[model samples]
Target chain A: MILKNKDVLGLEELSAEEILGVLEIASRFRAVFDRPVRSVPIMRGRTVVNFFHEPSTRTRISFELAEKRLSADIVNFSTATSSFSKGETLRDTAENLAAMKIDMLIIRHSSPGAAHYLAKVLECSVINAGDGAHEHPTQGLLDIMTMQQRFGDLRGKKVTIIGDIAHSRVARSNIWGLNKLGAEVTLCGPPTMVPGGLARLGVNIEFDLKKAVAGADVLNVLRIQLERHSSKSFPSNREYHRMYGITEDVVRTLKPEAIVMHPGPMNRDVEISSEVADGPRQVILDQVANGVAVRMALIYLLSGGDPGALGVGQD
Target chain B: MEWSWQRIPSEFLVTGVKLCRQGKLGKRKGFLHVRKGRIEGLGIGTPTVEGIPALDGDGLVCGPGFVDLHAHFREPGHEEKETVATGSRAAAAGGYTSVVTMPNTDPAIDNTGMIRYLIDRGKEAGLCRIHPTGAVSPGRDGQGMTEFGDMVNAGAVGFTDDGSPIASGGLMSNALKYADVLGVPIITHAEDRSIVGKGCMHSGYWSARLGMAGMARAGEDAAVFRDIELAKAAGAHLHVAHVSTKGAVEIIRRAKNEGLRVTAEATPHHFSLDHSRCRDYSPLFKVNPPLREPDDVNAVADGLADGTLDCIATDHAPHTVTEKEHQFDQAPFGVVGLETALGVGITYLVNTGVMDMGQLVQCMSETPARIFNLPGGRLEEGAEADFVLFDPACQWVVDADGFQSRSRNSAYLGETLTGRVSATFRGGRLTWRDGG
Candidate 1:
């Protein structure tokens, strides 16, 4: 039931067993990343390019780290340094990259359907790192992996993603992943920011973040994108953070053992306070570590590599 | 220059002495010349007026054409829906000499730059004069006010957040204060969000029977009530846009009676149709300020008749076929009104014995011009010659495929309508003429 070598373009394409298979493979790869000898030869002699058109130090580095750990040669193609300045079409750029014998492309673009466009045009396997506030599949997978590692299973877990749901790729991706993993996800933010009918996606929704975060097994905080602020989506960053931020006081209301997580380059004080982000119950760093392993698993699984060959002894 | 005194055509002889000056003429005897496309003169007999064609104006009312106070010419950003050129042509065909375009585009017209862009693009199209409305809030976010003075200075005729209601009262009040200072009207699309959440069709037995979400009348009334109070508090000119419900009509009626500087507009659909039309779950029947009960339609008709409703504005919301071809709740609200408005007005108001043609002209032409401070709604000389020549007896079917708008989103498609516009003139220039 593993994903055959096709474009992992959207969550709609995945069956329940395929999703479970990805998670199981990701869990095994997570154990491999913790070992002293972290690198593998699963994708040896193959190249994976991280073509991130948007600004992201974390997702890019995590994918690069994952590719390097899987013994795949890594090339970073940032929009700042790329031929995007020369007005090369995205299709042309992707074709040029694929022409270099690149086996896979990990793409992040600032448009919702950018990655899907590349996937359609190129012969190489395309993994969407992020696509314009749409979905970040690896981040969602790693989040599920982190939750599974902490709780032994994601089944029946109450997971809350609080803040900027309207502009969060993380939220969209996580909703799909968590729903598939049998976790009851709750989305909480300002009513304007929290999309309507998320309950239709099998998720609970709340505007009051304080009430939403309580009794949750995982409190995943999403970053409020500043560009969205310029569009007047929110009144102000300070005002948004005041009402919905994961403060030390707010965290106190959660189950004592419940973990707080953020996909970082943390707007540490804006979304989650320094105290809570760096707190004992915080899995912020573990999520980052799990990101590389989960991505390694994604690349390995999608490229026809056997999941059991990773040496974690799969069921 | 040659002047000729001719004891000429009897029609001219009876009207005046046949004294002909260069280019000073009327009909066949008097001469009217266009020198480099500018009107040189209009009185004398001259045969040397080369390349200046003349039409015999026997019984035709020749003056500056018509102007529309409200038109949703979706363009610049969402051309898949409609463009300025197509919309302008539609306006011209409808006998509109000028159109005050709504500000609810993709990158909503909230700033001076977007406003300038709209003006520039409209001018380049050269079909009719397009005066853009500035959004009340920046990007119509409803959180803060846009620079009203900047937009006003940029030749914005009015201010509105037409697609969505201004959700915040404080911000709306502040916007009104700015409008008060500038002496511009704040046109509000009054729908309180709390009562209207995700409901597509109008609230009534039809919605309940169809198992569809019903948009309540309170959604519009609550906000209209709030805006009327806010307008009174600020003493600002408030224009209620597309007033739909009986409750809203009563409130606006009271406000006008109290001598509040408040005016309201009812769209053609509001006066013509009611919630019963939505019983089949037709998305075409869907609109914002969702079509209310028959009593509401009756109230709107009374308002239009009694002058409580100041004008009949076509909230001509155009959408692409793909955008409209969805389930009742999922499809976008609004139907194309520019092409169907006059016919609907004729059928529902004029034919029903509720109003005469003069009253229709007063509401549709005179009042909107006075409220928005635009010229050319009147047919007087020296004013922009803006007027629509309608047959008043011609009947035609509403055909979406034949419309000039880029989108086929008209709710009235296939429905037969009365009163067709025969010709439209703008600044004494023929912009549209029905086939001879």
Candidate 2:
């Protein structure tokens, strides 16, 4: 099945078959996304709205670009917390918008299940852009697409995610996506950065960076969220960088075929040295490039499109 | 919007009921007679009385009125969620005649006036006995002590800083000492905020798999360990609220075995659900000491079975539908439990043969009443005629819409429960009959 679900809420809910189905359709969109005058007519009349409760620059733009390329009329609902929250609640605002006849809702909220909440209240499909420290499905899908491009098969692939695993929604989503694909996922960071008990997701927990990266196929590094933690009580940046930072020397010790990835905007010389981030094998830009394609695939799939979009029925 | 109290007639007879008491069930069927708010007589056969109505208790077990040690009535503030009147109806419907309303309300029952407001409102509601627990700290801020002696004098049954623990060691010790002197048990929420930092559910593998912030077992256990030490030093009775984890259970078990004056209660959801229940991210399954692992659930059942856990409480936190329908992380934590507590206990505990009816009644009634030093929880002569009538085998599907509580956030919604509360009696009168 392309997607037996109505919403692209999280990666955790997708099965291996459903994930592969979405990725296959996404690969086709990658070609369309790369071409000049990237636009499609399949969803020309579909109305999409961006409901971002939290301030965001990157994710909203990525989703907006994907929507526009799909030829959908896009409306950005700028909900200033103060004005809308004074007399109207979120459900009321969403109901008012749904009354205007929007087709799909692309929401970036500070709360974890905001899109799911709206999906219940509204009569349209919903896409979660980013919600708190919860899953960002599109980011997870793009990262998976990037991994599949290099490895051809994610099954048995060793993927190690490093740095602030506690506060990074990116890490959480990637973990779920990578696990669903049958990859050997390893989470490496200080105890302060990585909250205990994630090993239940069937991931290897590693504190020492050297042991973590040894023979790893992909090292997905995450930026430290300073606002989310007390660096002094958690771990000092100096200490964290010294222990787990992806320095050039650390990259040299990794398996020769292993690739390095970071979901930017990167903290240069902190999580990763500029040398390794700009090194020969860095696929960080490719990950961003694939994001638009994955989101395009999601928009196509979640807008009630079936596998018939590709002239095939879920192979 | 409060319901008027129903007056008790001078005399009545409840015929052919199975009498249940502490440690054992009555050998044969019995007739119970009540006159003017007191149990007048009990005999082996049906009793004949003139000018007194007789209620048939066929296929029903009559026991001491269930006493809930912990529950949130949500009055003074958050009336949209629950009020004393609606919560009392819920309690009555759940087969409870007396419930200790926690001090976590809007103004928080920190002083004498708030306590009196609940006592008076409960009296006016005429549905259940509403005993108020005073906050251990002023404003429940965990910085300074409240008037424990004055609140107790004003009819506060116990003390607690419920929603959150008394965070400071010094403040906790001081409160413990004061409550000890006043002969009231100090209830602790038992969580170390620093260790539980930013985590929501149990810091188990399932939590990591779901990507929700995991509150470590050590977070609850460490505080439990600390509070035990504090209680020992202060010579105060420490009552652990909503015991969830195995580690905490072990510590509490050892403390009780060692005679450290410790007691604990387990919520029905804690023993019934686990962290895996949050796989779908339903806020209804979200609670304070968040549902634990499967092993922890078993340990909780074992704790109750072996008497390591002192009581079975609802922790019946009611929240508005809108509050619970928000995004999972942004949503408030809790589920309406008053109307479902007994049904769930009968379904999970008694029906499963984990504990018999006598043990269940003792935990739900006698122990809680004794712990808080409240009245009721007995069916002896001259005792207040407060009791519950229920069919242990009655099966019904849980429907939130069917709840008497103001909120519709019951965790057991859509679940099939075995026991059903038929009616509740208080002060020798029918306080709440199911259809009434």
Q: Pick the candidate with the highest TM-score.
A: 2
**Second chain TM-score, each model:** 0.86, 0.96
Worst 10 residues of 2 chain B by lDDT: B1-10
Candidate 1 per-residue lDDT over residues A100-200, each given as its tens digit? 98889898876555677688779888998887556788888788778887897788899999887766778878888888778889999887666563565
Candidate 2 lDDT, A161-275, residue by residue in tens:
9998876788888888888888999999987667666776678889999999999999999987766666244556777778889999999998888899998888888889999
Native contact recovery (fnat) for each candidate is 0.00, 0.42
B260-329: candidate 2 lDDT, tens digit per residue: 9999999999989988878666788888888998899999988998999999999999987777655555
Candidate maximizing DockQ: 2
What C-alpha RMSD does candidate 2 show over the true interface residues after superposing them?
A: 3.6
Q: How would you encode candidate 1's per-residue C-alpha lDDT over B1-436 as one tens digit per residue? A: 2221221111111111121111121234433332332334444344354433344432332223455677788776888787888888777766666788999888898889888988888888777888899998878788888888998899898899899898899988988888888978999989988777756767665553333455778898999999999999999999999998889999999999999999889989999888878745466888888888889999999999998998888888887665554435556788888777778887889889898766776677767777888875764323454555565667898887677777677778888888777666555455677663
